[model samples]
Target: MTHALVDSQSLPAELRPYLDGLVRRTLAVCGRHLVSVFAVGSIALQDYRHGRSDVDVTVVADPLIPARALRELAESLAHPALPCPAAGLELVVYGADFVGRPCGAAGYLMDLNTGPMLPNRVSFDPADSADFWYVIDRSIAHQAGRLLYGTAVRQVLAASSERDLYAAMQASVREHAGGEGHLGDNRVLNGCRTVAFCRTGRWLAKREAAQMIATSEQEFRPLIETALHSFQHPRSEALPLPSNDVRTFLAWVGERVDEAATHAGIGDPGSGTYPDG
Candidate 1:
């Protein structure tokens, strides 16, 4: 099976081959049941950081594949032998019919966050997994994502309205924001991007989203810079975590989301899950 999707040069030198293998293996395991696979999120945008990013993938299924088979596929992919290279393999496997249906569709078969290959641990949740990635992911996959196999994303996804897009972003901020969850690197970047997507239709990666917040938006610069630093150089010597700044920025985004909702004429969003993909 072919592995190359987007230009290899766009990503970090060390990380590309691993992703290639991942796409190849995914296609093999899914077989006929796999309608298509699209590499979404940061890697899709060529903005992945070797040590900090996830190999975000979306697997589209046309038929209702049995759960046992899917679990077995996950086991093989997450097996200690063939480990993931990034922080983890963040994969969302769902039906093709649900591509753009906002009211929710057939629950996902697998929402996996398989940890790094070394220890080979995995987090698999196949519950009614619907969230922000729907509209936003479709937009990304169609516009910039790498098609690993099957039909192109454009055909799989229907047109998205501005309100639908706003709802997705708003949910991302609302759900992931509250949790007494400290503003870690992931939170900072995601928070910024959630706000950015609400303002502008463009869905940028965390790094670029952080930039959008920093340069254009004056309020979140300190938090965005700190988060960006944490993302780029997590192991940098003597790097202080911007604890207060992160919390403050998150709260600020919550308010901005309210404005976005009012401005868009949509009510308070309910499915605000963190934008893991």
Candidate 2:
């Protein structure tokens, strides 16, 4: 097995052992079939939080892996010896054929996460029903992702163009907006960032996007600050329950998201397979 060259300091101390085990275990599972693996999300952006972050990884395999190989990979990841120390371990193993495809339906071999408060859950992420956020992930992995092992990120991963990203961001927001419930921080911040990216072609974290947008686009400051305060995780223990203002703000956001979706020409957000329903 090849030892992937990475800045060990980029990962939290508690997660190092788990990451090592993950790499070795994955290599064990796929052997020669494994093409490359990469670090995704906030880690690649160098904005990962120690306890708050999930170890996001993308592993690529030769096309059409056998069921046994997939099972072996999953079992290796869930091994007790490789206990996850952070919020969770999120992994997406894709087939080699996924390269250069839009893959709006991002099927994965293993997509699971275990959190401090949230329970360990394995996702049955069918390609058709996958979340559109994978579009954003694809962009991140291709544009500025840090390599974990094997081939370089840009060489292996296919990136959607800026226009595609805009379409995807709008699609994701439109789905949430049209859905039957209030939008959370994930949706709010994502919506804000989508607007930012549409105008300025930059992918930033929730707070950073909010701050940046609020600067030149002063009209969004109140909504952005509110989203920054609400954050992503549950907050009943720390703050009061949602007020009317929260819902009102999100409603406005929903309208904006829908408008953005229309302008970007991402029609029929509902046409795709949706699992959240």
Candidate 3:
């Protein structure tokens, strides 16, 4: 049982070999249980930066795949085994039954984070506390995911509800506000993306959304520019981001999302327990 990988022609030349290796390795590990493979995030959105971005991939496997097979698959795809072209690979394998389901309801079988920029983690629990990010990523996938192999994206993935997206946005903003993660540039750009999505009902690339926000939000232009510069030149010596200002910007964006959600009658912002990653 072999499946042809598709849609690599539109990807950057440097990424083709890496993606080919991923698909081939995945097929070899999962064998007949593999259903579909989707390239999401930076690669899918055409915003990939050689040294900055991670290759975000989502694989849908038959629910019957054995635990041993998943462990083998994870080991095979870990950084050193199959070198990643980008910073790392963020791979999540979900059961076929979970692909088209709603956010909270769709639990993944394996969430493997491997790369230079990220700490390696291999989780098989469906009840993992990182649903906040996973849910948002799934929503993005529904919009811009590129099918690298197996079935078409739309056939296996479903779009997230406006309310769920709004909630996830709020959770993300709250997490950043509480100083949970680093990478100040990513923090600023993520705030921009969240606000843009809330207003336009579309997911824009991090830099695209930051650029869009910069044009209209004059006060935040400097901060947005700083983020853009750091993202574009990941290897360059960069000044630490101003923590106070970043928090302010995120709070402001959270307010905007809240306002939009209220106007649309999207229910309580605190209605669900969305633990941050």
Candidate 4:
């Protein structure tokens, strides 16, 4: 795999102070119970649109707090604006979802879903439904430098990278597609393809997630038709097409990469594919 070159100094003046303050406040509020806090989602990736994005922050705490309550409280705290340059800000507390919850942000395009009590940032996976793994993987592969909790975040990152991501995807497919809830079966298979591609050095983990996020229901469905055709994986069979058209989707993602590269002072991975998604 190609190691991406990045200049950590690329952080924007607009984001630095806010992100730093977030870390300090989080640790102070949660105190000893706080395991760690890190930045993920769009902000860390530097893809946030000026008027459309909110800083995505995750805090891991002991005693496993209820995410709903945490989200509500956080939203209330940030409701009047947290004195940041971004249009808005939202904080999400992970862990404590018994009956499958919204995977990412409540009203936003992404969710930080994952298992309970563990701390790390991630993306959404229809197959595993573990938002934790998704965020952790994404953080390490693309925008982890934005992380705030130092050692705690580092431990999680080390563990995730130890295993082959393709293997993880296969396990997710077997467990979700061949095992239990079928909501994201087709996604599982596609995830498998993604993992395999990355393993073979054909794709980066960040690029893989971007491709999945960029995939369209109309044109991409046929690609995962066989996997979704089955009833065993009910969830996957039911995933509908995303709202945005292919052109819009690709443009959004393109802007994200450019913004991220600029903010992080990293090379922008050009839009790889925009096939009528």
Say which candidate scores most in lDDT: 3
lDDT values for all models: 0.66, 0.64, 0.83, 0.40
Candidate 3 per-residue C-alpha lDDT over 80-185 given as tens digits, one digit per residue, 9 for 90 to 100: 7888878889999998888777764338899999977677889999676556788788988889998899988888887777777777778788887766655788
Ranking by lDDT: 3, 1, 2, 4
Q: Which residue runs of candidate 2 sit more than 4 Å off their true CA positions?
A: 1-5, 12-14, 79-81, 123-128, 161-164, 178-183, 217-220, 229-277
Evaluated at residue 228, the lDDT of candidate 2 is: 69
Quote the positional error of residue 70 for candidate 1 in Å.
Answer: 0.9
Candidate 1 least-lDDT 10 residues: 117-126
- Model 1 Cα lDDT, one tens digit per residue, 230-254: 7776333324556566657677777
| Number of the predicted model whose TM-score against the real structure is largest | 3
RMSD of each: 4.4, 4.5, 3.1, 14.9
Number of backbone clashes in candidate 4? 21
- Better TM-score candidate (2, 3): 3
Clashing pairs in 2: none
TM-score (all chains, Cα) for each model: 0.80, 0.78, 0.93, 0.40
Give per-residue CA lDDT, model 2, range 131-207, as digits (tens): 56676787778866767678787777777754455556555755655534334555556666666665665677666
Of 2 and 4, the candidate ahead on TM-score is: 2
Q: For candidate 2, which ten residues in a row score worst on lDDT?
A: 268-277
For model 4 the local lDDT of residue 51 reads: 38
